[model samples]
Target chain A: MSEEPSPGPVVDAAFFRRWLVAAAAVIDREADQLTELDSPIGDADHGANMRRGFTAARGAIEKEPPETPGDVLAQTGRHLISTVGGASGPLYGTLLRKAGKALGDSAQVTPEQLRDALKAGVDGVAQLGGAAPGDKTMLDALVPAVEALSFALDKGAGLIDALAAARIAAQEGALATVPLQARKGRASYLGERSIGHQDPGATSSALLLGVLADTAEQSAAGGTG
Target chain B: MKMLINVPETVVADALRGMAVAHPELTVDVEHRVIVRRDAPVPGKVGLVSGGGSGHEPLHGGFVGQGMLDAACPGEVFTSPVPDQMVRAAAAVDSGAGVLFIVKNYTGDVLNFDMAAELAEDEGIQVAKVLVNDDVAVTDSLYTAGRRGTGGTLFVEKIAGAAAEEGAPLEQVQSIARQVNQSSRSFGVALSAVSTPAKGSPTFDLPAGELELGIGIHGEPGRERRPMMTAGEIAEVTVDAVLEDLRPQRPVLALVNGMGATPLLELYGFAAEAHRVLAQRNVAVARTLVGNYVTSLDMAGASVTLCQVDEELLRLWDAPVATAGLRWGA
Candidate 1:
């Protein structure tokens, strides 16, 4: 049999746990910034929403550690839906729940599987919000990030490289929203006046991918995300 | 938080708990944070349910008695209630005639209510929905994915609730709600912003002499900001916008609703000016109202909604009704 080099570290329950913890920490630290970003275009609750949602996820994980990687994500998703209010609650909740559900009961997650699960989550968010990429929403960041992650992985990039690509794509996508006029969410009410402001939802989506990438890198070294 | 709340997390539940005791005529389900008429799901009458974030008090809750809403599902402040709450409220209030949901057009409100409607249907309860998007301040806003629902929500709820109370079929009540939405238009102006307890800061800063025009109930920014104007100028701008949108040649019902923190004395003065402006445009104001009926927390502003009312809507508007926030000819 032809010898094939081993791939990067597999995403297991521990990886997801660490990933969620990292995500929560990042959100907690950046809450005010997110809220400030939203004040000009939203209800000024994005940061607070994320803080509450991720805190609930963290608390739930601590109280009842989930069994499978999917279970951990699913629990976190459920908690976000309940504790977080506003559009962010249902939108982000859908993302996690869809991604988690896509993982099924698998004990180990391949890079391809993670990529596909993430796409599923992105699809769910778009469908629920009825938003498109240029709508200046979280999808702006998420769609590009998911596309980049899958593209990089399919081209034989390592898991760490793929996550890095995704994070960069997400960040760039968030920045690109600065010139766009929102067509969805409360920002849409501003219409043309909405231009010149970075979309808060996109900014948070970038934060999400940033943590995911950081977790992947740390996981390679047997460290926390 | 500087506001009068035990804690940020406890705001919704605690206020609802107080409401339960405060109004024996209403049944407050603190477990799910729903308020229902004590005689909810009354036999053969079609039940009406409406709710959104909780900060807009005396709305879905205070209007949860008599000829308003049969049930009100209050979510956390400015956050739409979850599907579970709405589903439970629907199940609890649905009579054989079916239940109707009066939903604001905010994206969160629409999505959550849509989910609950599906859940309610799965449980064998018939349901219909009416989306009120009457705010002409901006076609869409940060909080609203489409047209923001504002003061017109009160008119739709009250009028439709009255129809359902008189044993109107679900379709008729839904139609009434839709008509009210189509015929009504609203605009608001804010002198300041309010702080959510969670944020512990004003949503946005408005320095002296500047005002946010076309504001909504969420205390989000308005369409434009301008120097502070005289009450007469404010009245003229608000009324002119409403009239332009509706272009009503017929008599209309006028409601001047205050954002929270506006004094009644100031509101009445503003209302008088708005009436004068409407008359200047040769618009006949058949009915007029002024109050803090619909609010946006502590945002100091007011919105004006004018509806082209027909005989049917007029009769419904005059119907005897009793609620914590509204009572007339009861």
Candidate 2:
């Protein structure tokens, strides 16, 4: 049991806002890829849905800048819930809103705070959608992210390192959904044919977590300034 | 791969603007993406509200007016509207009588509408909800959720809206809507895939000679895919599916709807085949409407809806309706 200090930066309201903006950009950049994946199993609007939802969320955040990290996330959640029109909107919106609500009026979020916030988000999504781990939804990615965050927090890692671990876990979880048969939403209608395709919702969720990881790392290193 | 949309985010808003300009009598809420009767909330009359994603045009929006929906909220393409829009629309349309919400069976729509109803109830407004699950494609077994709500929704909106306009109590209006849902059945097939505006691409890949059967309103994958067949054959299958689910022996109202990309000529041709099939089966045809009432972005497909009509239903059907998406005189 070696005692090694975790290396990372603190996350604040500005970082949370950046995370959302980056998430929108990431969705825009990967919109075609998402559509391509969706063409096989769905109506192919995954990319369009994410792009519209994130763009609207970003615009809302910019229009009314939140004073606290929770505020930023809450506002983003509300925007996505209202503007995006599919299952993803409400699921993601609930995630953000619950997380923001957990964070309350805090300007900065510690690793434990983020872990609790993520748990809140996960609980919120589960309540809203009734989706489980193998349902082939964003929950697949988010569940793993929350788990990884909790693991890092338990190990006494800092916010940045914990977020990085969560990002990796989310990416792996997103990839895992490719081979599993979809059991919820429109894709479930295909039955066995839905297998072997990456879920668009999981992919976008992974992107969001990855961007948050990057922002946390940057802030930790004082590179955001 | 086939569509004509400028920007994904702007499509619904721009369309509402164009609709407002074309039909000045209807009021359009560009910000909230709601269309309402110019003289909304008739005194002492119950208000009716319905909405869904943006791609299904002339649907919720088109049915908003004198004898139909008091207001319709438009969500993003293939998405359910947020609670804000629903609450706002409910508030806008609520008269002294109350408000009736017409929601499809989709999970998102059901959840958001429920939230909005709660919000409205909190504000001391009476609100009731009716869920439409008319598509007979998916089974309502324990394994799967249930059949989706589809083209039959148009009939419910029209008939229920008429009932509401006639000063039916909220309970009666909801009951009428529920009866229409129970008596109706629908099925659809797609010749090609539709492209969403934001994604700027098609939702699914249909080969040049293949078709998808039993598709949902949101371009969800259907029951099966087979080599392309003639319009008569497609209509036969669609009618058979609907009839199988409905087992109708009485006169029924029929709607052969074009799913965005299909032309009027094809719809009429399909309708003719459906008429023959239903006639051969001894099911009386009370009324018929063949057009693009609800649509999936640019998907090339058509859905057949059959609603068993009684005397009361017929009277409601013939009631006056005037709105941006639909129009007819008393």
Candidate 3:
């Protein structure tokens, strides 16, 4: 795990803010699709709950901006946990909160730090949800995305390229959930009947990672400024 | 659907406001959505906390009084309450005797309560949990999220709450709760689909002349569906389902519960049929509770829960109790 003096921009609080703002936008736009995915096997509120949580998080960040990357994510996680009332609340909240804690009050974080932090977050999610990659949960997408990012960064890829790889891995992982039987959440109650429907949690996870990749690309191009 | 609600978004809040006005003995925190007994943190008594989705009224919130839960956190309809609510409840009700969380086995409730227990324990409050998973309708536990905690929740809450009320330690309270959950079994039959205010329509479509067997409290799809049957036939099927899972050697406490919309007239008739069937099977009845104790919102259905009682359990069951939902002999 060499540091190799990476050439990509080090992410700061502003970069994390842009990523979350864009994430909220994408979640709002795709809320209906997420809810539709949930109808077959879930309680059909994943979309609404995510929309409510992210929108509230976005508002909180804008109302009182944070000073560091860790603060931004930790505050967002707290808001999501309070606002999103379901199994997703704790799972998603733990993902960000644990990752933010791993960020450790750093004002700026390198790609390697972000990667390790997200790995920590995903690990927390697995512990909280007691789910694994094939459980037809968000972990299906998140675990692969973090691994792809870690591998790309370890190979000296630029942050933008590494995040792009992560996004693609996440998307593929979400698609992979369609044929697997759910073992965890509300969907598991359906047993075999849950096989055909893509998990809404994994879909949302992919969308969040995609937004992060896009944000990285935009920052690299000086577009976010 | 034309529900008697101001708007779908405020349904839970509005109901809480109404509950606050109606129940002066309870300290209702409308903004935070945690309901506690007016006199909470009852000295050295073990604190019992239970909650889940809001649609199942009188399940958690209404049962938050003298002989039951010390606090109840109501979430949005068919949604689990977040850990913060549970943490706040534990903080408000813990009186140094430790707290026991009586959780349903739904993935949402389980996850939230697990987090809450961790958070509370981190704050130096000793915590224990007992998960109620008594629905015999769910046959597999290894592959699925285990059984749906349905009507049997009332038995666990009431019986364990009684034990807690009598100055039982947290370990004893939690053990009795687990024992109650182990001895109980439940099965529900839905005559119609449930309509949540958020969905503004039936959560699942159940056509006329059709019924769902083994319905979860949240309207999750059950074991099977069939054409409608009489109360007698429904009772036979429902009772048999519970009996198959619970081969009771002792007399049992029976709960003939209605889903939100069924009237007492029908529930009583169904209860009579259930009693006749139990008698024919040679299982004595120690006591019976027939009403809308645990309900799916506006769903025309009934669930039967039977808890086999030994001498100690029968004594606890006969204890005086007072709650908004269940009160007797106090």
Top candidate by lDDT: 3
Residue A78 shift from truth in candidate 2, angstroms: 1.9
**lDDT tens digits, residue span A1-225, model 3:** 225534566599999999899999999999878977876677767787899899999999989999899989989998998888888888888899998999998998988899999999999999878888899999999999999999988887878888999999999999999999999887887778788889999999999999999998888678443
lDDT, candidate 2, A86-172, per-residue tens: 677778888999999999988877778888988999999988887799888889999999999898878877677778899999999
Task: Compare the candidates by TM-score and give the number of the best one.
Answer: 3
C-alpha root-mean-square deviation, candidate 3:
2.7
Q: Is candidate 2 or candidate 3 better by TM-score?
A: 3
In angstroms, give how far residue B153 of model 2 lies from its true place. 0.3
Ranking by TM-score: 3, 1, 2
Q: Which stretches of candidate 2 lie over 4 Å from their true place?
A: A1-3, A62-64, A223-225, B1-5, B140-145
Cα-based lDDT for every prediction: 0.87, 0.84, 0.90
Q: Is candidate 2 or candidate 3 better by DockQ?
A: 3
Give the runs in model 1 whose Cα sits over 4 Å from its true position.
Answer: A1-6, A61-66, A223-225, B139-144
lDDT of 3 by residue, B55-125 (tens): 99888999998888999999988889988899999999999999999899998899889888999999999
Candidate 3 docking classification: medium
Lowest-scoring 10 consecutive residues by lDDT in candidate 1 chain B?
Answer: B138-147
Q: What is the lDDT, from 0 to 100, of the residue A207 in candidate 2?
A: 91
In the range A1-225, model 1's lDDT, one tens digit per residue, is 013423566689988998899999999999989988887777777887789889988988978889888888888888887767678888998899999999999988988899999999999999999899998999999999999998988778888888999999999999999999888887787778778999999999999999999888888776432
